[model samples]
Target chain A: MNSTSAPEPAQPTERIPAAERREQILAAASRVFGERGYSGATTDQVARVAGISQPYVVRMFGTKENLFLEVLARALDRLVTSFRQIIQEPREAGPAATELLASRLGAAYVDLIEDRGILLSLMQAFISGHNPVIGAKARAGFLEIYRMLRDEAGFPPDTIREFLADGMLFNTLLAIRLPDIFHEDPAAAELMRCTFRGKLDVVLDATAAESTDADAAPAPPAAGHVDAAKDDK
Target chain B: MNSTSAPEPAQPTERIPAAERREQILAAASRVFGERGYSGATTDQVARVAGISQPYVVRMFGTKENLFLEVLARALDRLVTSFRQIIQEPREAGPAATELLASRLGAAYVDLIEDRGILLSLMQAFISGHNPVIGAKARAGFLEIYRMLRDEAGFPPDTIREFLADGMLFNTLLAIRLPDIFHEDPAAAELMRCTFRGKLDVVLDATAAESTDADAAPAPPAAGHVDAAKDDK
Candidate 1:
């Protein structure tokens, strides 16, 4: 059989630099930690998802706590960046700045949740507020976003608070996968219709599409293939 | 030593029936599980807080999972019950029914969080939605409240959704203890002022009073003083 068959080609091992690998690991950790929460998740699981060794994951971040902090920080950073981008965009002088800002930021938030991990992970961080370190960071991170909207985005305090209130409610909706329950549960369907103002289908479609993409992606091989070889044995 | 004090009077242990004991345990568990997520809390802590034995705590609820389910159920029940009470109260016939209802319901929620456990526990439960059992209960429990507002209370779907949105944001504020940060963080103070609309002082006072009440309560001795005696040893 070996003699008759053509030799198998060697698989290419893409060499990712340290900075890129760090980003990859943080992204994977966000998803894992978001799903399992801080205490429930482990570095090993993050490593597996990131296709990196457990030791390497720890070495890169120092500890699971540090990794979670980094993930949370990145999530907050992304949120601020999104809001800033929206504020920077040119608009027709129609709606009041506050109203336009609210709508634009609300849509931005809806877009952000398409990633699933980012919003959920930030929520998990907030729920873990009993931990003094995490609690402080969560409070600071939350205020940072609020301050950005108030000062940078030029939204009034009331508008900022209202926007955040709606965002938080949307977080709960996504956390419980309310969109999935909509069709089967009439109240849920009605609530979503009212909450999104007839945009329920759009959000549902976007979420579904993202989930499909996640499912379709093959597991990336380990950086060195060391663990991959061990698994085969 | 006891005999020296004029034959110390007999310390009578008030016999609590199973039903009362169950309620006591649920209340304590709500506080514990609210402070510590599901995975972080233990039956022993609940038992200690309830002045019951660990075995009794487990026996009463059958399992930790069942205890959590009951706690969640009670939280939802309390919310619905509060809203119902508000709806039944005679109105002044001045403000629109929708505005009156919203204000009443909002005040009820603020009062509920005075316990600091009920609202936070419900939020923690919602965040634990990745677990199948919890996810189902959280979804159903949330929908139960929404349906009550819609079918029973006769609020429009839009009003219901908007009410829930504000509620979810309040949950986040309480979860992160924004009231505690209000004085130290100008942004938090502004956010609370805007969100509460000049009612920040009222909430802060209420929250402070509740914390003082919690602090003044005597620690409950475990049943038969088993664990209490062990700690003494």
Candidate 2:
């Protein structure tokens, strides 16, 4: 429903390929949508962030809603692929078998701070009601993640529900930028200490690095990548 | 910073009291912020929903951000007051003592569908990170809820974490309006049936009733109430 035919041309030094341009836009969309939110973000901002023309963004994705759908799909793909890879990996068997798997999955989710948008963008999607196409796609993808945990991960429904809930909680901490303030607020510190534990330093460091880079430039998008490193549980 | 002096005046036939009028705006803000989110809502829209003049809205709550802070405080107040009341209520304890408390708390949360905005508005607050005044206030309130469960309810850290996570998940389901679609999607239905357990029909009915009323009129603002029914765990 973007009726903006007015053009704001991409001031690219040279012509970028359409496919590459689309990837750039998606990457930019993730950050913009994640930071600003789906309802709040506009293609013009995404285009500006991507260093592309506004019309070009509309041409490729058609609408902000559609672009957010792609970001959601991408985030879900990252979760599926990452979890599958973790499942396939060799692990030491222990008395607490599921705990090991859960820890790895938890670490993978924390590691997603490398691409913070994956978590935050999904936050935007979760709150969008189910009647809309985004709502349907998001809930279905969320369930797909749920089913993966249930069927493949061999976790019970309650366990899977807890895992998903924990993931959403972690997502909340990040979205609220709690990592930045854990040192300041005692309650936040206690919670972060408990939530992150050993990874607290790592998350803090990742957030620091990301913020520093964000101040200087937009995050290098996870364009055209399907690696475990991009896995945002 | 809403600087729009171009006023769209309220059409109230008679004068409404200042205290009552303030409550009306807060109630309207809850739904508006819950639905549109903090970043997405404007004072103009909040004023419209509250049936007050835009300039009057600006006069009462200096900015949209300030208005949201009040809404967040109100939601947290409702949570605290409700939970305290539940704790005070006499219970028929048996072999499963805490389960009774937990169930009562869960029912209280479900009962919050009466003012769905409290849950959804808090959802908006939870995901807001810790630097902005909103982020700081929201997280602190959230942790207050956490500590209450730990000290008063006497649940362990992991259990508390799980409880908060589950609450967040429930908020996600509501935010995405998953209850509305449970009948249509099998995965959704299975999850709803499991999550809602004995309260599925109640949640579904409440949602249906809320949606119908929402279509017909704004669900009544929970202005200055501290009843057990408002306890959104």
Candidate 3:
């Protein structure tokens, strides 16, 4: 019901004006869903919050779920922006990177949680079934982020296939979306941060010390098989 | 409606058989919910998966939500058990502890994800509103675990009040429960483990080095203020 009055001018303005309208709609959806939850929220509420009519909202996005998925995508893009900002600022690699990344990721996650917890909750609620639309969109965003980090970590795309980025993505999402779970004991957060730093260091070090000749013949499929098998349930 | 069954004698077993019963119920609930989304699942279905009668399941737990909460508690407890087993072993404090803890936590988290994804989804669904009974139970269980770890970490009973535990719990839960986000990216899991390990080492070292002098001062009012802030949204 929000399509007819969409603020799109079909022409460019000084601000690429469509961007501002999209942001307004996304923010409204995030706030509404975060507060009222996904199933409990309505497109009318989101439209009202966006200062746009319901038909405009429909024009911008077909449905409430669709709007929610778009917002989640934007949130991830924001994280990528933050990560890039951190890396390009000429920070040292060791403890500095660890601490900065922790705090940055923590803040980003907290903000995302407060803004879009309900949408995340909805995604979690329906992630398992065979519904590919929402899952694929979110997964594709995650893979895009991981792909950027692939060269940073020095792993081939084929080998990265055996990994599970979903676990980490969920961890960050849950940390923000479920503050009660994270805020229960302060030590838990500290412990988790330390754990993440240590493991990240291992990956970075392994990548830095990689041997070009190690891939000469395939290095025995059994080695990769055992590694993958152990990782498998 | 389910309480219509006759109440049995409250005879206690050698070690608290009710605990065992709770575990069995949780195990069944885990598999059932993991396979089918919560909305698609029923108490009878859980009972069948658990190999008990539906009435017995209802008599023991008031509702599906209650059963799912129990499963979450069990899952957290399982992770804690592994952590304690490794941490308390007579090993020196250093990188090895960090590595062992990270790898073990990662493995346990992966297992939980594979085994109990559905229960986590259900718990998350009721996290926001209309499920205080379940929320309270889950929060209390989480707080209990957090408090236990805080005491061991040398933080006075009420001194350390960061929801770090809650964040860790939620993050780890998401890590496993939302495999679509983590399954494809192994480095994500590795980075999380390393990060947590690195930060946890700082905490453990501080606790180990804290002398009677540090503990002598009755925690400052600032500490309380900090706790309040920490607990605030």
Candidate 4:
């Protein structure tokens, strides 16, 4: 668990800009909330992960719910942005445009789950739907993704639905870490082999590779891509 | 939320036999733990739901974890039992046996999800996989279902995997109550329409129908069915 937490600072005296600090805190909060979930996570833990004071953590976010709202929003935004970029990219002229788009979009989702925190945090939000604010956000976020796939990506309704269904299966598979648990069981192994088809090794390898470079620089956005403005609602 | 909790007893003083009382408590615990999850659920609430004292609840299960394990075990058992019953039934001759078996087993799964608590509790167990005991139970339970599908039902690896994948998507859709959320939005509604492929109404209607008869008599087991002894592991 400690290993999964953010690394301790080398020198505590270094001061960062407020905007930079906010991003840092949000990143740490994502990991904490992702791991422990919204109800189980604490600002104290988020602060510790961010290498900041607990009071500052609360002061920055105003409340725990507020902090979680920001985390949920950010995770959703990243997903929406990832999908939008894939849709906007130029594609070859062929009868297979829909399949190609679906494949690329699926790959993008697989990449997003590699972050671990992003997908889990979104799932936590969905599960915590008894809270009206969280429930509204989850529903709206889900709808936004659906709309992007259908309207923006121009995929048929059935195609989009199948894509989302496959995505949900992948989410559950990753959430349970089925690969790790079923590696020794033949039937389980065969099930996973069919579930992921040929992409299992690619996803597993990518996730493994990402974990080793825990403190590596963030990848730059693709050229000509613009981050979508946060949906205030 | 209170409405979702077990209804309060009209007369709380009826003394039931210990075995019967244990089953009552387990049923109530399933609902509470399903709705609130393991961390969020409290034994006091389970006691209230069961119309028994908290002390009695604790005495029966020893701990919350134990109670949850029992609930998890029961839910998994019911699911396995449902699938096994479907597989054991005589089917039409020819290559269509596999398709017939898959369809019947799928319907059995859809029926189990109508219990609400059963699927949610099992999902919560999977998400709480960091706990060694819970993790082991969840893995073994999941594998048991997979093995039952493969060995007992004789589904080929790919067919079983796809069936399970579709099941996961259904679980996610049900967990979020997508039909209720998307009813007001056209595009969202279309996506769900394609996702469920005309079966959405059936699932929603069945779930609604089940909630009304919360304390109805349990359905009798099929003839020739033998209850598999609980796996102590």
Highest lDDT scorer: 1
Candidate 3 lDDT, A86-176, residue by residue in tens: 5455555674554454455444433433343333543442342223465555555645555654554333443233232323333422323
lDDT of each residue in B43-86, candidate 2, tens digit only: 76677667555688879988878888999999999888888899
Per-residue CA lDDT of model 2 for A34-152, tens digit only, reads: 76677667777777567555677888987767888899998888878889899888877777778789888989988776775777888878877633688778788878887778778
lDDT (tens digit, per residue) of candidate 3 on B39-158? 435676665444445677777988776776666666666756755665466656674654454454454443433344433543443343223454555555544555554554344332
Best by DockQ: 1
TM-score (all chains, Cα) for each model: 0.82, 0.79, 0.48, 0.81
Q: Relative to the true structure, how large is the alpha-carbon lDDT of every model?
A: 0.77, 0.74, 0.47, 0.71
- DockQ for all models: 0.58, 0.41, 0.04, 0.38
Candidate 1: which pairs clash?
none
Whose TM-score is greatest here? 1
Rank by TM-score, descending? 1, 4, 2, 3
lDDT of 1 by residue, B1-233 (tens): 11122211243335788898888889988987877777767777676566555677899999998999898888888988898999888876654977887888898888786665798889988887677798899999899889888887788877887788888888888777777777899989888887776456677886655431222223344446545555453
Specify the poorest-scoring 10-residue window by lDDT in model 1 chain A. Answer: A1-10
Which regions of candidate 1 deviate over 4 angstroms?
A1-15, A92-95, A209-233, B1-16, B51-55, B92-95, B209-233
Kindly list the per-residue Cα lDDT of model 1 for residues A141-186, writing each as its tens digit. Answer: 9998888888888887777877888888888887777776777998
- lDDT, candidate 1, residue B202? 72
Whichever of 1 and 2 has more TM-score, that candidate is: 1
Lowest lDDT block of 10, candidate 2 chain B: B212-221
